[model samples]
Target chain A: MSATTNHPMVRFEGVTKRYGALTVLDDLNLEVGRGEKVAIIGPSGSGKTTVLRMLMTLERIDGGVIWVDGEPMTHMQKNGQMVPAEPKHLRRVRSKIGMVFQHFNLFPHMTALANCTEAPMTVLGLPRREAEERAAELLNMVGLGDKKGHYPAQLSGGQQQRVAIARALAMRPKIMLFDEVTSALDPELCGEVLQVIRKLGSEHDLTMLMVTHQMGFAKEFADRVCFFYQGKICEQGEPKELFTAPKNERTQQFLRAVLEAV
Target chain B: MGMFSLSAMLVAALIAIAIMSLFGDNALFMSGLLQGAWLTVQITLLGSLLAVIMATTAALFRLYGAPPLRWLAVTYVEFFRGTSALVQLFWLFFVLPLFGISMDPFSVGVLGLGLNIGAYGAEVVRGAVQGVHRGQWEATTALNMTRWQALKRIILPQAFVAMIPPWGNLFIELLKSTALVSLITMSDLTFRAKTINDTTMQTIPIFTLALLTYLVMSLTITIGMRWLERASLRGMVRGRGR
Candidate 1:
């Protein structure tokens, strides 16, 4: 494990999420070992994306606690007890994670290089020269070194997704979340983004949690595969075991449906 | 936008200026109107500065402030937006003295109209801020940005681009509403027209000049805003690289 501490890179202890009357993630307990690539797959409304969203702190969980690098994300230990984290505490813990979205949410007003450098300079307080150097390096890694001056509007969907990935990686997050990063791309474009993901997986010792519909990639790349159903993990195990001989009927049905859709 | 061609408006302003100069034989009449127009310009400048500040603050408060501060912002926007600008001007000028908040006529004009126009501008600002994609905000969170940092570095610059056109309309509205100050006893352009018309009964020339002056001023605002919009977008999107 690449973990700096004895604890797992991420642990979800009895985490529950709800939206008004809907319970999206129910009493979910999961853990990710450092440097493990976990892929979450399920049908729409099965709460697959919510897992990544909750981890990223985009949507606040209604119940339970999430730990990153052995520390609670939404709550902080106060003397002997836990309380909801203050902004300062939350920001500190949350900085360990980063996310890329399906929509490729690049800041439309900034150049590709600016989008990558802004948070590092402003939030991390890196000087312009260092930030720019780091950003330029990441942009090149994502294969957009020549396009750093291009705005989001000027790039293709695939190029934008790569930039978004670079922007997320620019934060030097220990845990990266991919929330359907290629769902919006053209089929030809999906390959370029997937190639970046593949390269990042091989190159970095970072824990990755990807919510995806790409069964092939999940089966091939993920260290473990989790199939979520009705906000519960119906089946999870080694990707080969789960793909070859899933025990849960719901998992089998979901996999069959997904295969048919292709 | 189709009905509101900018070049056509500029041409109309030129025609109005031509008409004003054609009757420049009435030099005293022209000069009196000119002085009034100058006061209008000053009031518009100061009031607009205040309005922009108030609008941005109230919009931020309404969206992200604490409970009490949010309520204060809500009440402010509703009160000023829901009521008449003229009544607001009157209350600040005529009624505030009863409440131990007396001000000179000029201050009242600037404060009252600044606040009233700011109320409308708050909505514009809010719409533009919220109009930014939800994912942009999520991206900020993913990067672990402080709320203030997200707004200042990421959000507001984007929102500013969207807001310029509506803000231009509000500015022109503010310029037109400067006429209301004249009713409260400030010697603005409209007041000068009414006064010189009453004194000399040169109704045709005086009222026409006043109407033309307002048109020219509003046209100037429109032109300035167009320039600002172009300048801002230059570095923002594709084909307009810095």
Candidate 2:
């Protein structure tokens, strides 16, 4: 639908990943337009998170390339041949991207404000005063301004995850990757993180690629949804259309299982 | 109680008092022993400093360097740990001259004590580093931090706290091991005791003072380590944060 959204913000061209004999992702291809929220849904071990991990460079592609803002990321052109991107160049390209992991991955030793400020001050080279001011703003945006001085162990899982979202945002990334950000939270705490994410998606005009199991949130929040199975996208389409009337039998089965589990 | 049991208890208690008085007395022999023990304390302090620097280097090389460097780290750790420190100290003092490398007595003593403890300290440093949660690596990498930056700013600070307990244990061991350096004619505490015994013809008194000084040094280090541990670990538990 929509003819693949010309000049996509994030594009994967025949990406593949393998863990020795396992083949975690097999010749996968996808595209997300600028400022679009796309959710990936699948059973455990279905390569759903692998897609996000690859974009974040936590996992490298076994074959093919990824383009962010229309520039190649997985490989660099060297001697007129595509080679694996060098670490230095890869870091520069990756700085434009941000990721929030399932476990919240907050720096345990730092307070929430310090966590938000660290990347800005260290990686972005912002002055301490400026970074602290921006971190305060981010904390307020995530509705955790009061918890800024608290370490991760002092915060609830949901609160820590929201801070992690704020930390990712502090980098001012063009593309944000969420790898099951809510799956680690308790049912009662999940709403707060999801709410912050939904607000960011609407207010910031951010490009987002998320892996989540909250079918209702995915249906309401994402512009498009992709259903993955056995290391490949089984089906992908507009959220409203895909959830209500899936084109693939696998997607229908997955939706039924997820809904029943919920 | 019977006289035999009562007397036996009295004898044990007197021995303890005698040991205590050896450290506290103002006798000529006590002062002589203390001067010798001072040498041991100084040697141990210098040796521990060398251990800290060398162990940190060995651990970093093993973690970040090329295969040859890593192999060298592993070899260094195993070599010193595998053999007795006495042999290494003796070999350094005696054999290296064949290859035209001769260090002074004090340097040899410090080097020997340092390298012996460095082997064990390297393992402690390595474990503490790798023990950090893998999530830290991902978070730092996501921020696009250079490897060294991540280690210095994010990883090593936490690792340093984790390392203190093992380092304390190493300090105590290093203190005890410094006595070995006296064999190289370093005039360390043990060597000083021998020198005094030769001059004053008082073996038991000099040795008793040497033992008490060592005990004091070890106890001081133990208390210091406990204090360091508490200070470093302070904010880890909630409700205690200042």
Best by lDDT: 1
Tell me the spans in candidate 2 whose CA falls farther than 4 Å from its real position: A1-6, B1-26, B194-208, B237-242
Candidate 2 residue lDDT tens string, B42-149: 878999999999899999999998999999999999998999989998999999987899999778888988999999999999998888878888888888888998
* Residue B163 accuracy (lDDT) in model 2: 89
Task: Report residue A58 deviation for candidate 1 (angstroms).
Answer: 1.4
Relative to the true structure, candidate 2 has a C-alpha RMSD (angstroms) of 5.5
Q: Which candidate is the best by DockQ?
A: 1
Chain B TM-score, all predictions listed: 0.93, 0.84
The regions of model 1 sitting more than 4 angstroms off are: A1-4, B1-4, B235-242
- The per-candidate count of clashes, in order, stands at 0, 0
Please report how far candidate 2 places residue B156 from its true position, in Å: 1.2
Give Cα distance to truth, residue B138, candidate 1, Å: 0.7
Clashing pairs in 1: none
- Tens digits of lDDT, candidate 2, A90-149: 988898899998988787778899989998998889999999999999999999999989
